[model samples]
Target: MKKTFEVSDRLFELYHRVHRLVNESMTEEGVSLARSKFLFFLSKLGPCRSTDIACALNFAPRTVTEAIDGLERDRLVMRKPDPEDRRAKIVSITETGRVVLEAAEHPRKQLLEEIFSALDDEELDALFDIVGKLVDRTDEIRKRKDEAEEAAQIAIAR
Candidate 1:
């Protein structure tokens, strides 16, 4: 139990360390890591509504709105009235956004490469497997929780 806790603690710390490093490097290049995710999504998906970005990114609507506002202010993205729904707006990445995103990606990729280069082939393979297992277990837990909630809702309805 102690070993398990120690391993998880180290993993958590390592995640934050890497995240901080990546964010710092990207920020120097004019795009914070958090904002890059939104740009990446918009670049791929083209124009979509705030609701869609919220759902796809698993972010709260208000959080998405704030991020979009910042991105728009920076000229990284633009929002226009939805043609189909006057009450809602559609957000899309600007050409400038694409250029900035591409530029920022280089440093992010290079930093990750430099960090991962420390691991040899065997370590890389083992780390990949471990991460895959952890992700699978997390997904399994989420599914079970969702099922349990549905069951509880059904019982309450009766």
Candidate 2:
């Protein structure tokens, strides 16, 4: 394997290791990483519909509904009729949810800090720059792939 492949593999393993540690820490505080994402979104975005959460999180409506149901059952979130659309209910984080979310966030942050503290300031800056470039390239490739697929579909239709 090329050095690039080896580096990629190491990065992948490191990511999973870090993620697992963070999840474990958060779980000890009574929240999973997935649950934290929803709580964080609601805490930041204020009240919104399940459909809104689905779009924002790139989850299916059913998945968001199920998650919201669980959160509601736990008294982490609440739903009420939307003022603008009576047919839809808006979801919001309760004070209890906020408290739990904050608690969960602490362990996640602590774990990340412990992991990244291995890197000095200069190394951290370089890593951020490299990661940004990789993300940008990935987005560009995805956009081109999407456009190519769209063009192929158009050609086939014609």
| CA-only RMSD, every prediction | 0.9, 1.5
True lDDT of residue 108, candidate 1 = 94
**Model 2, 58-110: lDDT tens per residue?**
99999999999999999999999999999999999999999999999998988
Which candidate achieves the best lDDT against the true structure?
1
Q: Over all chains combined, what TM-score does candidate 2 have? A: 0.92
Clashing pairs in 2: none
Candidate 2 accuracy as lDDT: 0.94
How do the predictions measure up, each by TM-score?
0.97, 0.92
The regions of model 2 sitting more than 4 angstroms off are: none
Query: How big is the RMSD of model 1?
Result: 0.9
Q: What are the lDDT figures for the candidates, one per model? A: 0.97, 0.94
The lowest-lDDT stretch of 10 consecutive residues in candidate 2 is 27-36
